[model samples]
Target: MVDNSQGHSAYSEDALLVSRMNVKPGGKQAHMRDGWFMRDGVKVIQQMVYPPDHPEFPNEPKGMKAVLAECGLSQQRLRGKCKKCESDSLACCYKRILELQADFQEQKSLMQEVIESMGHLSIFLLKFTAS
Candidate 1:
């Protein structure tokens, strides 16, 4: 007869492994992702502060003046004072977050594939050794 206790122990170990790999909602992983987004947003804002022609931001998107105009904010108005400008800024940040998240997911998928392959190899070795 198969040992029920051994089966149960194996099942518990698998469960633990899965739980460790899964990211819970509102958990530490979520907080870390949010923090990364905030950091990226800050970087975007800092980049916006420089003009496109400025040596420091040669690739900047037409400068903050153009961005403000695109968002329908007058040059004299503060970004916080204009709802459209704030929304546009948030949209830019959100786009950046989405791009980063996609790259992260791709890397995670690759890592998971590697892990699964290793697990298969281990299982094969165990079976070969047992036989």
Candidate 2:
């Protein structure tokens, strides 16, 4: 139960889950509270500060670079400027997620082809390897 100037309401189980997730592991006390989900907090902060489709950031890579700079991280991983950047805010996340999914699917397909080519020899090799 929590009380405020407005009123009091019963705390739900979801509230408990949220509290537990924010707690640091091993009971170590942390002054700075974090989000319930374990993700890139800096990236989340950057996203909040400079949303995907912000006017200044019509381009995704530029916006991401700016945010990374603010967070004191070098943009070594980001490739050169993108010629065609998505304008829609939702589309930004969607496009990157789809690209990642496609890459993963391609890798999975390649792995399957390799496994198929290995055939019975792979199984025999696996059996001999130490557990």
- For all predicted structures, in order, the TM-scores are 0.16, 0.18
Residues 24-67, model 2: lDDT tens digits: 12232112111111136522422212245667533222232333
Each candidate: what lDDT?
A: 0.29, 0.29
Q: Model 1 over residues 8-127: C-alpha lDDT tens digits?
A: 223221121212221112222111111111233442222222344676544333332333343343234233223223334533332222223322233333234454667742122222
- Candidate 2 regions with alpha-carbon error over 4 angstroms: 1-44, 48-55, 58-63, 75-131
TM-score for candidate 1: 0.16
> Where in model 1 is the C-alpha error above 4 Å?
1-96, 99-101, 109-113, 119-131
RMSD of each: 17.2, 21.1
